[model samples]
Target chain A: MTTARAGALLDRLGRVGQFLWSGWAGLAGLALFAALWQAGHERYGDFILPAPLATLAAGLTIAADPAAWELAGQTTLRAVEGFALAAAAGAAGGLAAGYSAATMRLARPILTVLLGVPPIAWIVLAMIWFGSTDGTIITTVLVAATPVVFVGVAEGAVTRDRGLDDMARAFGAGPLARLTTLGLRHVAAFLFPALTVALGSAFKVAVMAELLANTGGIGGALAAARANLDVAEALAWVLIAVAGLIAVEYTLVHPIRSEFERWRNAARPWGVKR
Target chain B: MTRETTDAAPSLTLSGIGHAYLGRTVLDAVDLTLAAGEVAALVGPSGCGKSTLAHIAAGVVEPSRGRVARRYRRHGMVFQDPRLLPWATARANIAYPLRLLGLPRRERRERAEQAAQRVALDRADLDKFPIELSGGMRQRTAIARALAIDPDFVYFDEPFTALDVALKRRMQDLVIEAARGARFGALFITHDLMEAVRIAHRVVVMDAHGRGIAGTRAVPGKPGGRDDGTVYRLVAGFLSDDPLFRHIHDIDERRTP
Candidate 1:
């Protein structure tokens, strides 16, 4: 390669290095979290609280076990399925409710009642209705997560820039084009943050419902660990569930959210170009 | 310089236009005719229903009592503010009308680029969103958008009122060029008599109460080349000579006993 071409390659490598360094900085934050865990371990006895290293050892052993994979997969699948259904339902319902005042007035009270009932109450009902199956876990997750997503999407749609809508209308844009392009872009802004919270809620509600219903998952594994008084194993299962949540969030949801929000950077003086 | 000698009728005509809002009478029986290839500047006070008249002509708002006859193919509008899409780049905003017409993505991009070039937007600026551009650049993008579909007529609702003086004058030059070159009839609304005098083939004056069009005065020069001295002379003559134009400065003399 020519000297200039080689120099450009080096410049690209330097940018890659900078990006990796930023990720390493995030790892440093996890190290601080480890130190706090160590503090908690030192305060309590071995039976009550395990050391961070001990939990790591337990987590690794669980990761290697074939049965543990089945538990992990069930929990992840149910949580994901539940969250996806809620997101779709919420988005469509919210678009309708946000655009129409009559729908909003009717939905507001119904949504309020839905949000008021706890997931545990729903789990009891779900268990009685669907038995100790994946249905219980998934239903609980959906019930817990849907209301938050609906509120965010509804507010986003209602607060859209009417002027922009008028501009689009004057240009003769069809209804579908205007809704997808103009309406959805604004909704995504509110939807992403709500989805983050909802996803987290979905996992928590799923795990709780599984434990209560005694369906096979990380929650069942934790219950067994608790019966045997294995603090390290219980904590290990909790850590695995969280790691899955973070993995899905950072890899799937976050990238999509950032792609939609890329336009906002242009408004800033020092824009964050990818 | 000359009106269309072809057999085609006027591009737009407002016949006995009248409008009222929420039981308040704003405009009544205002008749105006804009021929093909002509620019009619509407000068009146802010509340003199100038914008209302423009809106009525553009079919943006239906008149309470008259008919608007549009003999043209496509009509475009430029508002006081740039009113650009915050998310779209300058080129995309310019190409928006075409997109609405269901053009393909590649064609839209090409047409948008061509439109951007018409308003003298640099290649770099065309890719920048509205918030990234200067106010003048934003307005230019708006104008580019207005002219993109090869409109037969355009409504200028005080489009340049938000720009700086120098930028406004530059924009006026662009408008004049577009007005003449495209042969599109325009209904230019403004409160500034100087702006109206600079580019209008005919200056339409409204009564002080904004109830009706009081008079119409034809400017001596063509749309693009009027000298400031001639504009000043005509403005002076309108204020001093015409009854409705004179009403702007007159303080009702029927006040005392």
Candidate 2:
């Protein structure tokens, strides 16, 4: 038993090593993107597009200020809060609609209407209601992100294996037991990708709402830089915003998603471990 | 009930069971009974609603009209697809019903291991997911899952139809051995006369239109006692000489009402 436990630990270490080793590919992709930015910088000159290194330098300068960390943290907190609310609400609603034909019929038209309204329009409405507070940014982000999660979860629940459901029933599992044991696990596959998309939009919508509502965050900094016409600072704030997004996605979302979908990795061929 | 009376009562009984899909009838007036420790194979052509009947009997489907009385203490089902949860390890899948029964984690693990051993699944393979296991291994895991609950009655819904010939034979032998050793009653649904002959004490044929059962024939000996030659000869005789099997292989996809 000790040896088996040791073996499992080694296996986990190897997987972690593999995950880190795969970072080279991500780094290469980012390098190619930086190279493209450099090309654009040379073509348009400093005013239109600053060099990638120069933007990085400006981003570093902003990072030196403790106040700027608060700004970035503010935006991060709002986006994460919005994402949590959206995930909870969407998953609950999606499960309801997925299981009940009547609920699905009722929710479909409402979902279409929600999706039809642009985030900007919702931002404007939120600005009037909540007025330059975290609520406006969070509300806009919630509206923008919820539908994506709802649709993904619903699709997951709808496409769940009836065969497994029947198997559980035959084994004497009650409705609640079946949902907890089988239903949630199946829905996780569909839920993860939807959550990734929702999180991305949550951050984007939060920034937009912050700027429109005159709330202080990365977006407000960008507005200030725009007025000053400091293209480097504006670009630096943009970079910082994107970096924040990547950090949260990798640290929080992707790890949780991978945990849920570890079986899918086993399904892949050995040569295609990533 | 007393142990004597319980032993005498049928493990499962279905009477006047009828089912429909939307408005179309799929099963009608199906009355069947399984005595204690009896393995009965219900055979029919494709789309003849034998699967539906099994589902109804297992209480997985609500029949439009019927009464189902399950006297068995507990039951398990093996589906045509194996129906192992894709996300769970083979061990976890085997332990699922036990978990539902609120067995402690330690006992669940112990019983799941024992059940896996009965199906001849490797201990190492228990940690692997369904995707990592071969088709045969997955089916074995499904069987192991069924066996884990220590059920008195089992529902086999074409469990080995997807396996190749040699593999099918091995699985059949596995089921035969499991039934004999465990002494659990089973309702095995299948389209293969050879399979039915190999694994069951009696073979029940369903009507083509799902109106009701057509007939039943008792096999010559107990399951797992017959040799290959006897099984093959009996199946061949039934296919060629028996009127009950005349429409067994018939299929027309457009014939569904």
lDDT of 2 by residue, A94-209 (tens): 99999998999999999999999988999899989998899999999899999999999999889988878888898878999989988998999899999999999998888888
Q: What is the interface RMSD of candidate 1, in Å?
A: 2.1
- Point out the worst 10-residue segment of candidate 1 chain A by lDDT: A265-274
Per-residue lDDT value at A86 in model 2: 99
Tens digits of per-residue lDDT for model 2, B53-145: 998888898999989999998888999998898898999999999999999998999999999999999999999999999999999999999
Query: What tens digits encode model 1's per-residue C-alpha lDDT throughout A100-133?
Result: 9999999999999998897789999999999998
**Which numbered prediction scores highest in DockQ against the true structure?**
2
- Candidate 2 CAPRI-style tier: high
Candidate 2 clashes between residue pairs 3 or more apart in a chain or in different chains: none
